[model samples]
Target chain A: MNFILHISKLDKYFDNLHALNDVNFDAKDGRILGLIGQNGAGKSTTFHSILDFIKYNGEITWNGNPINEKTFDEIGYLPEERSLMEKATVQQQIVYFAKLKNRKANWTKPRIKNWMKKFDVKGDLNSKLKSLSKGNQQKIQLICTLIHEPKLIILDEPFSGLDPVNADLLKQSILEAKANGATIIFSSHNMNNVEEICDDLVMLRNGEVVLNGSVQAVRNQFGKNELYVTTPMPKEELRQLPGVETVFVRDNEKYKLKLSNPDAGVELFKLISKGEYIEEFSQQPPSLDEIFREKVGETNE
Target chain B: MVKLMNKFKAIVQETYVNQVKSKSFIILCLLPIIAIALIVIVGLISYQNAASSGNDDTNQIALIADSGIKKSIVQKDGDSIDSSIKTEQQAKHKLKNDDIYGYVKVTKNNDKYTAKYIGNESIDGGVRDDLMQNLSLHQNKLNLSNNNLTSEQIKKLSNKPSFYNYVKSRSNDNKSDDNDIKMGSLQLLIYILYFFLFFYSSITATVISKEKGSKLVEVIFSSTTATKYFIGKITGIVLMMLTQFAIYLIMLFSSYAFLSQADFAKSFIKENSNYVHQIVSNLFNINLLFIIFGLLLGIILSATAGSLVSRREDANKAGQPVFMIVIILFVLSIMFQNNSNSIIPKILSYFPLSSYFFMPIRMINNQANIYEGLISLFILIIFIIGLTYFISKVYKGLMLQNNNEGWFKNLIRGVKYR
Candidate 1:
């Protein structure tokens, strides 16, 4: 896939500590790339470098070319840190961001209206930012990030401080931005949203990318032969089945068995077939969160 | 170009709206109102106190002299004497009078005239000087009559002479106050400008530095170059200043209109006429224009400069340079008012920071010509532009520093990088 934003062998240092070490990645059009890491794992530093807020030794190319002085107007950045003046009104703040992207307020006003409506912001534009709820302010920030219709939108912790309804509204907007041919890179600690929205994932540990690939591919790569059997059998009965070393009972009658490395799921199915009716017996792979922990050796949560 | 301009406009709008939203703007707007009210209340009370105090007098003196000599010595056409022995006596008596001031006794003896002046306080040096010069003329006349000198000789001696005292400095060549009413108005000019510039520039600095110090600078920087952002900030500040000043001017004019009865206000309006002439004569008093323009240029330049070093503690430090300049410029302005044509101040006016003082002094001193004023004004304009540009260049990098160490290194780094 062609990447809208590509960072090649990026290196960043602060004093003695290497903040980002030889990081390489690509964020393509029409997709949300989830960047997951523990706190202080260079997630914010990487974003800052890409957005030209920091000086680092690397080439960050946008649309197959280096980001020189001129490319600043093309990308829109929503930093994890809040940046709006609390004294300023919502309309004023959005207009300011839009103007920075080199568009007039009049031109961006209609788009702002659409975005605020889309985000389900229920407030007056004339009200100052401090007067708005945190969730509403966050939504305003999201609208500001996307108001210019940027080609590459970087959302750092966009779902932060948002309720489910508000988060869902933001998610819809993020998806809309993606659908409009803008590439999105979403960084958040909220794994549920990450699991739902991201198709590609990059897991970082100690300022290094430990895993990167399609989400399903990464998840499918690290897992055991799994089966879910819901039957009349209890936890003790499932454990006694041939080739099953351990059985985990879930929701009373539901049973999950772990087979030996050489053993296959065929044995578990045969044991469950003896029942008059087998409720749930299926092979399943590891989830993304489980795969993340397996690959990085540290639970993200 | 379109895109860049759009971005700049948006930023300017942002700055304008944000600043207007600030509690500071409201505070700034209130300052002038409070000042004007304070001045009016204080002025009216003082005027009333002075008016009631004006009736302190106890005595008067009558000058008795022979009609022929008094007529010859004092130029009086009729009963009402524009220049007379009685006028002089009245001035002296006003000095003596618990009911009057003080009284002077004038006597004429043949060709020579003798005069006596007595007062509680010594007569003002200026008035004393006037009396001595007239007495000296009377002595010269007596000498001319005794020596039997010709009228032509007397005319040669008595003719008003040209004042030719050339001052060629060790390094240069050049030549070169008021009633209490005028003096008070002039002093008011100093305090008013001082109060307003500090109010305006410090607020601008604080507001700009605060915005940049917080997270917003990065957010704003992402969409445009620092220059455009700087322009936007400056524009917003200018708007804020103009708003405050305009309000002040309105209050000032309103007070002038209402308090037309008070001596100070009358004096202020009288000086306002002088200000008009000061402006109109600006075409001739090129020196005045240069000084005013130089000060103006310096203000705008330093305002931007103050922003360059803007950070957490920078407002305090940068404000020092700005206010220090204001204090210095104003001190020179006051000193220049007294000397008007001092050689040193004249040269100082040609400079960037000091020139603001120098130009005005030269003009008021009657030393600077229109040509010189214009030349200095032009130079001042260029210098301010160059300095502002330099500051903005430094500001672009300074805006990135979050800590003290970063601020110092980045200040230099920004300059070096540029």
Candidate 2:
């Protein structure tokens, strides 16, 4: 099924503060959409609106229909603040949450072992959640979210407190869920993770959708202004090149340059290469991190 | 609707199982039984001690009086007097030897009787009173005989009258007996209601606040609506309460059955069989409906209070208002329990908050009719329904609110969101 979650001009006000203003986005099936924002940027508010957990001034529809109780059964949400029943065993917690999502305990029970192995969770089924390390507990929470096989998965800050290995495990699981034709939408501060996994991206700033598109398209819109070159070119020489705005030394022989325009990249590449062998010469759009800071920094300025 | 109900059932099952399996629940369930067993054991031991002490010969006293006076006074088999010590000299000798507890002397002078009790220490108040009554009775018999009255005439003059009470409001022939049973049942029901309300309200509040504090409500709300979630939670706790009550009832009946096999319990049951039947009947009447509704109100209100806060530490503080209301109503109910016919209690009998306390008391006192009880119950039911609906509406907003704002501010914010 080609499931799609559509939000249309959603607006939310908390007392005198406009928490979300005319926010609009769509998350399609079999794809990962990353919602990114600085602190207090209404990313959670947008998720809340989609989940129908709060009162807002717009409509959120799932597959061209209003989200309802049955839709909720097909939807799984992992909240920003990770919390599970500390007193419950891993199996009990997973089964309980699965049951809430309309899955039978027997069905969830057998799958727990596989998920434990997949996530490398170092606890047995009967181990209490509190007995596990923080990373292992988060893995258990992730298992709870995906065990029901929800078609629409909403995860808020799923990778906030994970080591690189654990984060890679979660990333693999998210991609697996996506491959199974689930609509996965997650919010994160890790721009690298977002850039790596997100097929689509929505950036919110001060309760407004500042940027929205596929990850490649959003990054490409900023042009290939960033250039990394490892050559004999000194920093002073790189700064003197036309169309090069700034020169940054990354290593003993490497230099990174920011172009004032996309056309500047071609000129810069030609100058750095010079029909000779260069160890590294690459020009690409600015990283999502830079774009995020620039967009969020625009407001601060 | 089926899916909604399924989710509701899931929530209820989770809550019920989680709580029923908790150490606190197990401890609470066993606490009363342990306390009851302790009380019974202590009571039996005390009774045995008293019974054994009653037969001590040294604890006995001697009564020395003229033969005419002694013959006129009637004595029971267990009277503390030793008939063997017939003279003052022997009585004094026994007292000095610590063989007797005391000695009493009786004499008549100028048609008046006087008694003197002598011992190393004062006699028991009960023994002294018994001796004084015996001397006064002998004096009365002598006075009547001296007034030219025959013995039969004196006996006729001393006959006591029979007394009975008749209440105009009660339709039963055994009004006083029924009233006694109802009064006793009313107190028991009130105590149960008070205890269950306080206990279950706190449980409901803690359950909600814990979820809120742990930030697990969003995941829960995603699976079900707030109304269904609230109803499911309250229903789950109510079912747990019923299960606990059932356990207690089973324990009570089992204990009764075991005790009934004993000779003392069997005789006691036989003596108070009518009272027991009446009390059981009264417990299952309309008053029970009031208690159920009253408990539901308390639990629902406490749940609302619980939702008003975003942290577990604030849960007890949030519940304080509901607890205060319950405390006030309980106090008022007790104060007006005997004054059911008074205007204040009559007025309170119809109010939902106080009616649970006053209506049952008035009905037992025959100051309120069955119709009034039903009306009060109806009002309570309506109030509970309305409050439940209102709280359910604001529950989502309350659960979503994460501000450190105080409860009242959060409540206002939640209401606005609703």
lDDT of 2 by residue, A78-114 (tens): 9999899858899989988888888888888889999
Q: In candidate 1, what are the lDDT values of residues A3-46, reduced to their tens digit?
A: 47898898987767998999999988888899988788888888
CA error at residue B303 for candidate 2, angstroms: 1.2
DockQ values, each candidate: 0.43, 0.75
CAPRI verdict (incorrect, acceptable, medium, high) for model 2:
medium
In order, the Cα lDDT scores of the candidates are 0.67, 0.85
Candidate 2 residue lDDT tens string, B146-212 = 8998779867988889788766643457767776886788788778777878888888888888888
lDDT of 1 by residue, B1-418 (tens): 7656666666556656666667877876677678778888887788787777655332223233445444543442222222333565456544444444344466767666777766564444544455556567667767877897777887787778689986543221221112332344345545545665666667666666666655677777776777777766676666655565577668756765675656656776565554444333432344434434544554464445454564545655555557777787777778666675667677776777666555644654457776776677777877877876877666656566544543345456556432
Clashing pairs in 2: none
Return the lDDT, model 1, position B252: 57
lDDT score at residue B254, model 2, on the 0-100 scale: 81
Q: What is the DockQ of candidate 1?
A: 0.43
